[model samples]
Target: MQVSVKHSLPGRLRLLYDKNEYTSKQALLAQTLITVQEGILDTNCNTNIGSFLIYYDTHIVKENDVLNLFHALTGKYLEDPELLKNVDQIPETESIESVLIETLAIHYLKKWFLPLPVRTLLLWKSLLERCFHVLSKFAESKRLFSTELLDATAITVATLTGNKNTASQINLLLNIGEEIEEITKRNSYGNLAQSLLSADEPVQVVEGMDEKTVPASALKKDDVVVIRQSGLIPADGQILDGEGMVNQSSITGESIPIAKKAGDSVFAGTVLEEGEIYIKVVQTGKETKVQKIIDMIDNSQSLKAAAQQRSELIAEKVVPFNFLVTAATWFFTRNIVKTMATLMVDYSCAMKLSAPIAVLSAMKESATKGITVKGGKYLEEAALSKIVVLDKTGTLTYANPVLEKIYAMEGFTEDEVLTIAACLEEHYPHPLGRAVVRAASEKNLVHPENHTKVEYIVAHGIASTLNGKKVRIGSAHFIFEDEKIPCPESLAEIKKQSSLEGYSLLYLSHDGILVGVIAIGDPARPGTSEVIRELKNLGLEECIMITGDTEGAASKIAAECGIKKWISQALPEDKVKFIEDEKAKGHKVIMMGDGINDAPALSAATVGVAVEGCCSIAGETADIQLQKSGLDNLVTVRRLGMGLLEKINENNLTIVGVNSALMLLGIFGVISPQMAAILHNGTTVAISIRSMQPILK
Candidate 1:
């Protein structure tokens, strides 16, 4: 249940085997072939190796005649006990294991040499003679004909003219070997063994604690823990109080100086670039967004689409096709040698080898580019999507509002109001808090140094003591009424202007006087309109806006982004329904958002795209996650998805189209089975190459 390889080898193996090609008849045929081969080789251990060695002077027996004689003796030895009894009736025998190994070696040689038509005919003719010569030396009834010699004889006669089946079989065998080798390299024993033997998932149990191993997960809420230079912040929390420069680059994308102090929230995974600070822990374990993202990615395989589903169906069909081809050939030719050649020419090998490999490789490449596709199905779905829906906040606007203007009440100046508010809010982490601080910094106002105990009201504002006066910075509702701060004429005018401009207002108060107000709002992302223009050029329709913001704000943002359709004041569920409704109308919509509120909608879309730095649920539910949380990723993903689809289409055309054509031509009497086999095999090589075309940059 843990999904670890060491913990679930049998389950993992079952999953892996189930994913490979399967058809009832093909399964039965492969099982039957393996069973028959194992039995025959076991019985012929004493006789076949001796016959096989007679043709070779050295230890290595490279001739095809010797290999065919070995297969004939082995097959006959197992099926006809009379032949074995006669061989025993002759004389002293050689070592059984050595002869058994040599017989296996001969089978291996036959499999190896059967696919090369240039040399196969010569080897086939020579091997048929050797097999007859060895059997002729025995009693008449005890003699068994070589299946290889018979099939080769059929090929020799059937290919009097230039037919394709003979060449096709040889080509199919060559392609199969190469495909199997490549697949083996990808799903290698080394990879499986390494995954199985990896160190156990780093557990945070106190039992595993040691001096050298500082258990970061041991941290708890509100606990002050010191971070060494370059060490990571073990958990999410605010600095109780410290003086240090920290690398906030991992979290805030700020590569420059970020001073740490009391009340500054520090997230886990952020390094202490220079000085150290003690921080409190807020969230951990599954509560952390990172863990949830991992869980989401692990579970994404179930959401496959039509393309992958069709490919799976095709693979399943190939198994039945393989068995039928082999059975039909066996019935007509009445030869085991001809049957395997038919089986060897199946397109299943290439189909099974390339389909998932191409998808997984693309996923890996996308991840390196900072995007994480949950599974192949989503990649397929994304490739076909036409409509893209975007969330206004965080997706197209800054997560934190930037300070644009300040309005003062009757007797207060903007600087006086902003300075007092910034001093009180300097220790807070909310977007509004940062906005006020930035405003003060821009004016070069020296924040009051002697600040007393500061405390925050969630979803509201900050309260602190400055110069022995109660200072409060928050929403209008929080600063008025009981506080008796009248709405002055100037302040009221600023509120009206901000509302029309789509800005949220933050009230600032000092010592019971309504000083002034700070205006904060989501600002248009830099170059956002240009990105939309590019998307339009790339065949994207008008961007649609979905948001929880006020109607005015939503409308403003939509216009800025060049979107014609917009929805406002909607909850998370509303967003999901909007996307579903579009889908119901036959629109293939790609929903884009980077918040927990967008998770459900993202999951509901034909394909969900999440930018990097989004909430865990958003990232997990999304079909495609961009590495950079920018519109640029949308362009990149679209191109990549299109390229992938084109490759798949090309493969389908080359492999399925060409092979079917050759088969029909052969069946109509214009070509032989040998020639058909050659053409069929060539199609597989072409398909694999076509499937591996690189995605556009």
Candidate 2:
């Protein structure tokens, strides 16, 4: 009953006499033992193989039963456990819940679980717990762990437990978890550690791909890798190829599955269900997605924040200098240990970790909400803006203005005007032509059945022939002066009104006579008013509209949107100057725009937010791009950015307060070096934890 790795005498005899030539069976037995030894295996690979071997060698699972489940999971090779290891972990393990949780925790929780410092601190605390667990499981005798390990683990574990229910609860739990709970309670590390521990299981927080992975050193032969739907495909191979749907949402952001066939490229860590894929290792397991994720987390500690770098430099200079003075104190008092304590307190981990982690966390937060802030610096700067300037066409209103109204001239019916208009505009591809064509369709007017040569007259309009009649659609200036068409009283009033309502007018003529007109306008989105109101409430100094349209049209649109000022008929160059003028007047302006014309203005503004579905040039020039072109994203950007600033400010205040008190104690020789190190590192860890708090709507 007491199974153990009893080597030497029985090993050769068992191998020779048993005649168990089945390599797969031996691999399974080896895998199960490894899992019991390691405490957890990937479970993705082992589950299928172990199940099959149990049924196969003993005839529990008939060949046909294996085929039925195998065919149901992967359409092919149900009898081959070697083939089952080939599918991505996520899709392969979607049917199993424990494997799903473990896979998610490995893929995302490890890579992007929390802010970097908070995650690092939590990881360290988790490491201590893991070490103890390892010792408890493997130790020959039940020797007690060191006080340092117990103290650190207990404090962090309690914080995690307390933080789960309430932040305040963490403080209450410290006394009961262990002897070191009191030590954690008196330090900042306890706060963040508790919060991380208290948080919902890391797997639950990981709703999407976060690139978590098993450590490279940990992957073993025949280890099962789990996959889930909506998970990233983490490995590359065709080991166990089962038929099932894979949600490639994590990798491609796609909603479809890749049908698993033999020799298909199976990515690591993808979620799988309704099919089973077992892979037998083509690529080395060390190069897996899980390994890469673990590698990134392990290496993240070396990625010094800007503040951390500065603190390190300060420590190098000041700590050495402080230690030199401590040497003199040691020389007088003959206490070497006391001098070592002075050196210990000089590390300043909290000051090093806080500010940068706050900034990075804010950037990560913005990305989650569909805004890609280019860098941490921009997030910091956006929080201080006072003015918001908007571009007229695509930013404030829809870029494709619809045909709002069509006015016919004397002797021309509205149908007559549209039929003729659609005919002439059919061959042209300008915004005006497209709008007119769309309107004609809505009115059930057939576009010209036949058309002649089409010509685009710059600064004028389009001209073409239909039914052997020369048709021209242009501005009134072109038609009246060149073609001698009269601009009637009705036509003049139509032009005036179009200009006042942000519409660009196009004139229609046939055989030297003005026949009709079409008025096109860029209408604001339905939710634009709410978005603008929210921005104003969030402390925007003023919202202004700038456009190349006529003053009347700009003013009218501005008034409707509740904007106070309008700059009309402004060219691209004028927009840049306007941004400079706003800055001169002491305003930090955020320009929201689209189109190539808005590029210069976008580049000039303090923060340029491009509405999604805009011109390629505008998207390229913008600092932030909305996923859906809407004013709602704009509101989200401002609110989330402000919340980020609040986090930074709070972290800064906490660091200052803790450091000041500690420094005050250090001057009095009351604070030991080890306590100082813990305090500094703990404070940094605490600030990182604070940054992870959810922002409000």
Candidate 3:
């Protein structure tokens, strides 16, 4: 139980334990370390090195405290002689090969040791039970000759005619198919769920003005918590105090970090990229927004597209016709082989299996491309999307705006103007504000905290008091019209030049007079125009740009991106209305946006595409999420959708053509019932495999 300090930092410490002492109780020691009352943020055990890494909040707990706790826990473990024995009793995960071997051994023992009569009875009982189950399903659903019914009929005929081998073969193939389907589904759901799970590290919660570290699961609604820079928010909550930039990209599909101050809400699973804040928990556990998203993703298969639903319905309806075909064959040919052949060559098998396989395969492909398509229905919608609505900022344009120029009025020097602007702008997390602060940093300009607490006016500017003088920085509309600040006529030429050059303007004023004008430029993303052209080539009828920027700025960006139509000074509602109008006109809309303001429009579109790193709300509302912040993958998704449809059609045609040929061969006595069943089922399995193949290439 003895330990020594391996590494120590301000809020982190690592200790190495003796491998001979705690050889198998690393997990037990890890559990004990986390239970320490001192604010230990996280504990990680490495049995190989016989060490533990501890991260704690320096504000609440010190390095000495952690060392003392580790010593105490080790002493407790040494005092309890039975602890190691108890730890050894915990089960380890079984290997897949081991599980498979065990299953095969059990099966072999039952099959080889049993008496012939008993084996026959056991096999017949299993076959009859399966047959009756299928029959019961058919009776309840009123669908005849489905895959289940076809399977049951084939096995029942084999058993009745004393062809036990044929019955056994049919049952084995059915079980294999079911296993493949179940594994495929489990893998798909697991990938998505794992992607959305919150971090496993402990979070620091505020208890009566003092910080305490606890596991995220221990958090409850109304509890206050602290989120530091680069830490994941453990639960959905509202900010109580302080300010920070939160990256809700995992939830929102937008890559931009949003500025959150007091009274603003933040969700679990999102990371705090900069600054820190105290949050009052609003939701926790399964009730969190991320959990709701996971639940939606889990149930996404239920929201099937019209085509998928129709395919299923047609598969079911074709069941009765399959029975009729078998009956007709038996009556005319007077051949039991032909009747069984017709039953084996069921249309429902390929019809039901291939569609889902194709969809799931496409989903897997999309995931590899960093895109997550919620359901097959959204892919279908994307395939037919004609009108593409794009949000300007953080969508087509780069989220990181660069400071191009600054025009200072007569009384203020450029450095003085920039320093003051940076001082106020540093308080918020807006992209433009961050640009100004970044520009100041690059120039090695030092801007002390010279202003009072800044008040951010959403969609406007920031207001504060600097040296007892009124200071304001925001849009031209906010300064010139709302604040009644008069811009000097001498600066008109600078403003005009900036607008002509496609630069976004930010006006800075002090004491009711315009002091400076800052020009910010956000370049179009790399290959943006080429991607737009490619989208057009791929049958996108229209690509429009919508933004809250001025007409001149919007026009310049639209021209650069090869988009002919654009709407300037658009609000959240305007984007929503544009999508709604397109839908009303019978256009399947693909709305791509990356902001909290873009959520409503995303929801209204036929398929909402959220870019990588977008806000959490946008991700939840978006039908498709692009893990990479680019338009190239959008093209990939479109092609994938078309390929899925083509694959489904090809599978249908092959199933029909091959089965008909097999049925005719059976009728002429060229093929036996066993051969016909093998061919029919083999073709179904082959087509299912083909459907799962990559669609891109």
Candidate 4:
């Protein structure tokens, strides 16, 4: 791909490339990759003019960096040809103006150019298609009620009155309205699909005994990719070797960093918080699983909100009344023109269309802000839930934990215990692990990995052989009760002091003998206290904390966040039971957490919100997935969901108020049937376009 610099500024650059050669999908893929890079503030790739524009911070990025990046991308794409498999997710949609003009022009051109009989047959053929929907629906219920049946009645009345011209105009307007609605909806989905675009980059792969760097897209099934600290895991794969603490907040919605090791599965979009691991690729691009889920959500009617479902039911119920109005006009006045006027106003049409239109528009607006709502149903739940349950670890505190103190047993110096602990913890880069490793590094302690074949039992301690002696390190339960290692008498004093100080403990035992203890302290994340206040201001009735941590530690974090209710030392089952109990009491509970343990509770909550750094299980189980970090977006989502419901209500009121006036004017001889048809369809089209407009900034 040959390129030339079109222009350049201190912090901006534009390059010209051949659109005819690269294709729009390739250009978009290139843009997605560039946008995610640090220091590149913005990117605008206008495929129309083949110009790629980039804005950056002059201090952070250089002009040569931009050019070199693109040069490297060219070879990377060649290595993995299917990198663009999900790039073309959004289909091109025609503007409403184009659809309306084309529909009207096509409808009239046939009437003018074709012979009388031919035009008549074509018009009836089009009208019959509308009649077919009505007949098909009526077949199921054995009744003449539906929005489609009402549409057919208007066309039939126009023809019976010997007004073929009115009939043709009516059909043409319906066709135009339908086309505009279809285009509007497709545009909504297109906007959302843009948010799911793949941001590909190069990654390190292990071959033989050495590691090689390759494009993320170049990875194939069974490829062993080495992910280091702060590197994004680029594919869904199982860890083949090594261990690390993974922060999945950006992808799986985990609240804190999770420990990953050999045999553990890793997902793409999760950051390697600490350590390094070799992963065997299971899937790439996240399109096979995610794209299909999005498809299922789009087509599944069961996922629609209750209000949307009610609007459909209301639309169908009113169709029968539309028939009654036409019948009364004919029976009392014996006026064919008045009957036709009532026929022109199909009251149910606008009601049904506007509801889903509002939902889709709100959903599209949310995607821009990095909120992935699975369905409209959850949005509604966000508004109604008052009792909010928050997970402590990653939600209230940062993943970065600090090693405040180390209490070595008698005869062992603090330095000796720290060195030994860091050696074992270096493999797992989770919050606590990262803290231990960092502490050792800051002290210039040289700790080498001399242990052989360490085993990590999840939710327990790690066991391995060190210098021909068995060693274990983890929670007190893992070291004492689980391993049956007796604790030293002095350790009881340390435990009492640590618990009162609200510090989490890590116990280390060497060769069945208790050796030392380490204390880890956590600070509240910036603005967490304020976010809790904001949630309360937004009508959250009560906020509570549930955790597996000791009561003292959980209480300290909960107090920092102003949470008064809590249940500590709870297992995964306990969290679920808490949510179910709240729901049973008729309280709408919103649960937020990010961990494997949180998955069941998330499922049992009235609305499950998976915060940043979540595991795959929690992300998949939660009702909503926050793509970005922090609780600010949780506030944004709650507002957005509430806004959607309000918009739908306002739209319903407008549809009813405006169309009812049009119907009255038509029946009372104030407007002709044709004029009523024009106004009625115009109102429907207006509301639909309004619904597609932004609900949030």
Provide backbone clash counts, one per model: 18, 68, 9, 7
Local accuracy of candidate 2 as per-residue lDDT tens digits, 189-218: 222211111000011111134433332223
Q: Which structure is stronger by lDDT: 2 or 4?
A: 4
- In model 3, pairs of residues that clash are 251-616, 252-615, 252-616, 252-619, 253-614, 254-613, 254-614, 255-613, 255-614
lDDT string for model 4 (1-697, tens) is 4567999999999999887778777887777677667788887676657778899888888998888777777756633556676454444455777777888888778877989888778768877888888788778878778767766877887777677888888888777777777777776676566554444566888898998755565677888888887888888899998887777644332334677889988887678866779899998744455465467457524678777888777877887788888898889878777777788787678888888877777776777777777778788888778898888777777656788799887578889888988888877555676788899999999988788987876556678889988888898888889999997888878878887656777888888888889898875677877888898898888889887777877887788777889888888899999889889999989898887788999999988998765766687788887777887888888898788888888888887788778777877888887788788888988898888788777
TM-score of model number 1: 0.56
* The 10-residue segment with the lowest total lDDT in model 2: 196-205
lDDT of 4 at 248: 64
List TM-scores for all candidates, in order. Answer: 0.56, 0.47, 0.70, 0.81
lDDT of each: 0.57, 0.53, 0.75, 0.78
Of models 2 and 3, which has the larger TM-score? 3
Look at candidate 1 and tell me the lDDT of residue 378.
Answer: 75
Better-scoring candidate (TM-score), 3 or 4: 4
- By TM-score: ranked, best first: 4, 3, 1, 2
* TM-score between model 3 and native: 0.70
Which of the numbered candidates is closest to the native, going by highest TM-score?
4
In model 2, the runs with Cα more than 4 Å from the true position are: 1-348, 411-430, 433-490, 500-502, 507-515, 613-627, 656-683, 689-697
Model 1 segments more than 4 A misplaced: 1-305, 308-348, 411-430, 440-472, 481-484, 489-493, 496-502, 510-512, 656-694
Please provide, for model 1 over 600-648, each residue's C-alpha lDDT reduced to its tens digit, 9 standing for 90 to 100: 8888998899875565456557778775767777877777776666666
Which runs in model 3 stand beyond 4 Å of their true positions? 1-124, 162-220, 227-236, 243-276, 284-294, 324-338, 408-487, 492-516, 668-671
lDDT of 4: 0.78
